[model samples]
Target chain A: MILHHLYILGITVEAITGALKAGTKKMDVFGVIIIACATAIGGGNIRDVLLGNHPISWVGHPEYIVITTCAALITILLSPFMKYFHRVFLVLDALGLVTFTIIGVRMTLALGHGFIVASIMGVITGVSGGVIRDVLCRDIPLVFQKEVYAGVSIVSAWLFLILHAQGLPEISVILITLGTGFSLRLLAIYYNLEVPKFNYTQMD
Target chain B: MILHHLYILGITVEAITGALKAGTKKMDVFGVIIIACATAIGGGNIRDVLLGNHPISWVGHPEYIVITTCAALITILLSPFMKYFHRVFLVLDALGLVTFTIIGVRMTLALGHGFIVASIMGVITGVSGGVIRDVLCRDIPLVFQKEVYAGVSIVSAWLFLILHAQGLPEISVILITLGTGFSLRLLAIYYNLEVPKFNYTQMD
Candidate 1:
């Protein structure tokens, strides 16, 4: 529970940074805050909807919106320090990815879905938020482009499933899954790794 | 059934226009076609997912992709004539809006949801594709800001629901709903109508 709150806080921070990076002066504060909230919770919302969860996760808990609003204000104020912010953003993004993937898989499994369905849900929950944010901001989604993004989430989900199947403790399974995702993402970034693009000519 | 086929053909046209408008020289024909299909089918995808329908509408009928692919090729080849294509795009967009809204309401009712849910779903389906298209093009959604776009869908949805409740036949309900949406949208554009923005007070 404590970890979940902290994870959500980190999401708020990332969402704020994303909003500041995407905002124009023409947009009002409400618009900026809404965008920040969407960036923070959009992926999870889509996942929940797909899973047939009603009221939505964030809609049921308005704290997420309040946190994102505060974060957005701070981000706008700290815009001058952006040079030092990228690393922080990257770390938080990785954290968000792991947290969302774990939660997604767990939620779907609890809903009686099998491993394959849970894994797909995990990936969707992990990456759909960033996709929504990018789409709203009018940019190519990093997951769909040159990044080892969705791959990390998928691997993490598989690891969690395998661990669960092996009768590992739930806490250990979660920790290991998160660690695997974080390490894989960090290594990919360090090595500038990317997913192979589909070859059109090969299809022809 | 005839109307359904016409609706599919209209979707094909929109997919082609969307691909041409995406204008990403780096993206190959396959990528362009995938995007076009996504733009065309994304709204219905959201609707079905929300309603907990599996396999998705487009996934069940893979021929949608083929149609969209052909549309993309036509758009790409005729790119030079796109400047004068706005009128045709407008017509197709209106048709898409009406068709999608009718389908949305029909599906929602089939799911046994109430009138309000059905109407909301109608508006969501009607506007979601254009929203997807704009996002892929990296532009602020035109539906979010300009014109009485979604509003027309909403009104038409209400009209359909009211008439249906009064024991109107299915075909009459659909035709009236489409006519209402299309005419209202065209009139809104001709008259340069816009949704009123929320007025927020400064928090000193």
Candidate 2:
């Protein structure tokens, strides 16, 4: 029950960031809304598609569409003051990522998938939205290039599976995974930790 | 019947182009194969996902994956001589686009969707692979910037719907749409025709 509300809050935050990205590109209002919705829902969309899950969640819940659209409009209105809220947004974004990762793992496991698929789904849910947004906005995906963003999701997903296998209560698993994943992401951000990049120059 | 073979040919051509793009970026062989697969199947993937269709075609037919991988390897081997085949590739690509668009429309209509959805799906099927390829390559999608690419798909889709509604034989509908669409795309390339680009400068 609480998780559902958190999911809503997570998507709303993601939508605002997506709208801000569209602002940077000077996209029209329609494009802003489209990008915002994509950023908020694209990760789950990709996951469900890969899993062959039908009737995508948003299709069944148009309220989510309304919510993301509202978030985008509000974001555009507050664009000038957005920089002042940068620190807050980062914290919220970190929380959202962890929340999304947990939800993804739980859902995948519920669908009878195992650890490897679960971990991939969790990371995809955590980062693919931002990747999609960046792609649509014509920027290199930040997750692929830098940070421990996907790494955090992978760890959290594995941790969740391990703890669940130990017969922990569902709530306990969620709380432990959330705390660890959130802290890891924040630390990575604060310390500017980055994964080593694969820069493959041609041998020609 | 013949459509199936055309579909296979279409994806093979798409995969080769994707591999070529990956080569220019100096990606590893694995990256080249992944991009090639995405370029060949990404359009249908997106269309099916959006339509909430399950068991994506490729999942059911691993042969498609094998075909694309083989195409990518062949492309890499032939990369040195590719410039000489540029004209051949362009014509093949045009055929692929029309083939994919027609298949997309027929699939959507078979699923009981109306014209609007069918047209959108057709366009997505025709151009989305290249869009995904360009996005992964960190380039603005050429279809969006400077081509009649998507426009051609849209026209082909609508034409298919209209001709099919006229109670023509299924093969006749397919042939007519294919002829007009293939010719239009070739003319677009030959004349360097382009859609008007959207350039939205922000108002301070």
Candidate 3:
């Protein structure tokens, strides 16, 4: 439960970073907070609605809003140190990817979905927030490109499921999943790994 | 049934527009096609998923993809007519809004949800495609802004419900709802009608 709260906090941080980097405009406090909140919890909101969970996660827990608001404020105040923003964004994104993937898989599994569905949910939850953020910013989503971004989350989800099946402890499964996702993402970024392009030429 | 097919066709056209606008340097043909498809059917997709309809509207109908692909090809070929793009976008957007609002309300009614839920669903459906388009483009959703945008759909939905309750014929209800939304949206755009902004000074 404490870890869950930490995970949410990490998401708020990520949202702040994403909101700051998304546009060239100097967004006012309200706009910053709104973008941060949308980036942090937008995916979960969509996921909950799709799963028929009423009241939605953010509606039920307004603390998420408070946290996101605070994070956005802090980021806005510290906007001068924009040079470090990229590094911060990368780290926070990796954290968000791991945490959301775990949460998504757990939620789907709890709802009695199969492994394939749960894995898909993991990827969706992990990347959908960034996708939403990019859309709101009026830019193309990085995921729509050939990035190996979502692939890491998919692999982590499968690893978590496999670990669970092997009778590993819940904490072990989560740690492994998080570690795997973070490492894979970091490596992908370092190596500039990307997915292969679709064979558009073959279509004709 | 004809309306449904028209709605699908409008989505295809909108998707193609989005693809052409998305730019070839930033995204390949496949990426453009995917973004366009998402923009076209994204609103209805969210509405159906939220309403807990199985299989999803687009997934259940593969013809949507064929239409979207053909539209993308045409839009790409006709990319030179940049002056007419905005005008085309406005007309297509209006059509999409009216059609999706009706679909949302009708679907909600079919699912036995109350008028309130149905109206909310109508607003959701009407605004969702733009939201998806904004998100795909990485911009703040027009729905979240202080626009007269979604409010028109909400009002039209309630009007449709009230007319239905008054024992109006089905065809009349549909026409009235569509006309109300179409006219209201055009008028709003013409006059630049906007939603009232929340005064921050009034808050504690």
Candidate 4:
């Protein structure tokens, strides 16, 4: 029940981000809905499909779609007030990110995948929707460039694994992972953390 | 046997295009290989995953990845000459698009989908790879903005559905769809066809 509500919170925040991106692109309602859904669930869809987990999450729970769609619609109405909520969105997005990674790890593990695979799937589940959203909006992905995004997913995923192996209760694992992961992400943001990057310019 | 070889040809061309795009972005060899494979086989991957088709094509036939990676390397070496082969690339891309659509339709219908679903998968198979490539490279999708790219997929998919329903020989169906779709795409390039698009502002 807590996990379900957390999933809903994550999807709702992600959908609003998607709608904001679509609004920036000045897209129509159809584009808004599509981008919103992509941001909210595309990661999970990709992860599940890649792992051959049947009936995908949204397919199994139609209510997720309804929640995301409604979230998008609400975002459309709330765009004028967006600037004031930029910091709020960032914090929510961080919370959602950690929540998504933990959920991903749980799902992949339940499907009998090993810890390494679960960690990878967790990252995919956390970051992929935003990648899809940015791509659709014709922007470079923030997860690739912004402060310590994808790396956070990998770290949190592994953290979940180690803790789970120690025989922690599921709720404790979820809460500790969520708290530590969210704080880690916020610190990364506050400090402007960056992954090492390479530039190849032989052609240029 | 013949269809398998044609599939190989299609991926080769798409991989080159992906390499060229990554070159423009000045990404490293690793990036080039990743983008090339995404462009070459990403559409089929997306289509299959969406339809719950198991053992994804590249996973089932690992050689496809090898081919695309080699294709990307070759493209890197040939980048200086890419300007001269603009028309050649366009022609090959068209062939790949149609071939991909046909393959997608066959796969989906084989899984017991109706024509409508098959047609949708066909377009997705035909165009999604390039979309992925452009998005990863941070460019507006050519399919959405350039002349009649995605439309060609829809039209060819529908054409294949009609001809296929008439009990045409498999080779004949493939050839005719290939010929007509390629020609139609080239003509659209030559004449510049466009779909209507709109920018939305206030709700009113």
Model 2: colliding residue pairs: none
Candidate 2 vs candidate 3, TM-score winner: 2
DockQ of the two-chain complex in candidate 4: 0.15
Fnat for model 2? 0.13
Task: Report the C-alpha lDDT of model 3 over B59-136, residue by residue, as the tens digit.
Answer: 456567567767776666666664466655666667667777887898899999999999889888877776776666
Q: How close is candidate 4 to the true structure, as a TM-score?
A: 0.60
Q: Who is ahead in DockQ, 2 or 3?
A: 3
As for candidate 1, its clashing pairs are A43-A129, A138-B138
Clashing pairs in 4: none
Q: Is candidate 1 or candidate 3 better by DockQ?
A: 3
Evaluate every candidate with DockQ and list the scores.
0.10, 0.12, 0.13, 0.15
Q: Cα deviation in Å at residue B56, candidate 1?
A: 8.3
Q: Which candidate is the best by lDDT?
A: 2
TM-score, chain B, each candidate: 0.90, 0.97, 0.87, 0.94
* Ten-residue region with minimum lDDT total, candidate 1 chain B: B22-31
Q: Write the per-residue lDDT of candidate 1 for residues A121-201, one digit (tens) a residue.
A: 787688777777776666676565445777788788889999999999898898888788898888888898775443221
Instruction: Estimate every model's Cα lDDT from 0 to 1.
Output: 0.75, 0.86, 0.73, 0.85
Cα shift from native, residue B126, model 2 (Å)? 8.2
User: How accurately is candidate 2 docked according to DockQ?
Assistant: 0.12
- In angstroms, how far off is B21's CA in candidate 2? 11
In model 1, the runs with Cα more than 4 Å from the true position are A2-6, A23-28, A199-204, B1-41, B48-134, B137-204
